[model samples]
Structures are given as structure tokens and as C-alpha cells.
Target: MPLALVDCDSFYASCERLFRPDLRKKPIVVLSNNDGCVIARSKEAKAMGIKMGVPWFQIKKAYLANGGHVFSSNFALYGDMSARVMNILECMFLQAYEVYSIDEAFLDLDTLDKNFNLYKFGCHVKRCY
Candidate 1:
């Protein structure tokens, strides 16, 4: 069976928005250490021309003018959320997986029953989140 990779997009930014439903769909950027650079950014933020590693000061004016949300990196909160996600994946895949990163994993599809439909399984996983 083929290996499947599961990863979260804009992880840090997504984590920040999880508790702030109001910020969903808005431009959100998660700053790097000391608020020095743009680390993770939401889809809206990317569309607004905010690139990763760009110094935050360079885009401060435009970002704020467009009602964008800025947040410092919160590794503690992100770590907890990631753990929760990994736990869910572990249970779903019967622990036949490896945590590739805080936001990514490699699941062993060979462990699943031969009758299992991968597409349906993917949709089910998406719905779970």
C-alpha cells in the first residue's frame, strides 16, 4: 500500500484562528520570534501579498489598513493543538502512523483493510476536524 501524508496548511495561523472564529476568512499573520518576521500566514494574508519571512515592519501599514490580524508565535498553544490532531489521527489509523512534524504525519495505509476506500476515509477525516 502507498504511504499517505497528512499535513495542515498555514499551521500557526490556523491555530491562532481556531479560538478566534471572528478572524476566520480574514488576513491573519503569525509573526516569528520577537515579532520580527512573518512566519505563518492564512490564505487571505497570502492573497494580500504577505510572504513568509518578510519583515513584519515592511508590511505593517498595508496589513493593518486591510484589517488584518497579527499575532506572535504561540508554540505552547500550537503544540497542544498539534498533539490533539495527532491523537485523533493515531486513533483513526489504528496507531499505524508516524508524526512527521508538529503539523504533518505519515500514515501507513497498508494496515487498513483491503476493502477500505481511501477517498471516503479522507473525507471522513476531514469531517472529523
Candidate 2:
């Protein structure tokens, strides 16, 4: 059996948007501590050319000029959401797994039957979210 890894992109921004569905299609950026830098950016924000780790002040003009949304780093909210996702993965899919980060995990797939279809499993996982 092969192991699998699951990682969420723009994790901090994604968690922030979970409570603000209005921002789903809008560009959103989550800043680092003290509102210093761009730590996480949604796909829309990336499309707007907001590179990760750039100081917020440097891009303030461009970002605000384009009506982008900015958010402070919220580790508590992100951690809670990550825990919910991990619990769902463990209880519904993996027999054993290791959390690689707040937004990544390594799942043991040995317990799955040999005939399991990986593509179908991936689609199922996506639907779970």
C-alpha cells in the first residue's frame, strides 16, 4: 500500500473565509503577526500579484487600490478548523495518520483495499471539505 499526503493551500486564508462566505470569490490576504507581511493569500489574491511574505505596507496601495480584503493572523481559528479537518480525515478515511503541519497530514493507506481507486478517493476527500 502507498502512503498519501493531504495539504491545504492558503490554509490561513481559507480558514478565515470559512466564516465569511462573501469573500469566497474575492481576493483575500492574511497578514503575519503585527500586520507586518503577507503570510497567506487566497487564489484570487495571488492572481492580484500579492506575493507571499511581502511586507503589507509595500503592497498596501496596490492591494487596497484593487479592493482586496486583508485579515490579521488568527491562529486560534485556524487551529480549530485544522483539528476539525484532521478528525474528519482520521474518522472517515485513514486508519492511521500523522499531522505534518496545521494544514498537512500523512495518511496510512495500507488498510484500504488493494482495488481502491485513488482518484475516486481524492474526489471523496475534496467533497468532505
Q: Which stretches of candidate 2 lie over 4 Å from their true place?
A: 93-95
lDDT of 2 by residue, 1-129 (tens): 577888997899999888899887899999999999999999999999899899999999989999999999999999999999899778856658889999999888887777988899789867865
Tens digit per residue, CA lDDT, model 1, 12-126: 9999998999987999999988999999999999999899899999999989998999999999999999999898888878779999999999999899888999999779867
Worst 10 residues of 2 by lDDT: 88-97
The TM-score of predicted model 1 comes to 0.92
**Pairs with backbone N, CA or C atoms under 3 Å apart (clashes), candidate 2:** none
Error of 2 at 59 (Å): 0.4
Model 2 lDDT, residue 114, Cα: 79
Model 1: clashing residue pairs?
A: none
- TM per model? 0.92, 0.89
Give the true-structure RMSD of model 1. 1.4
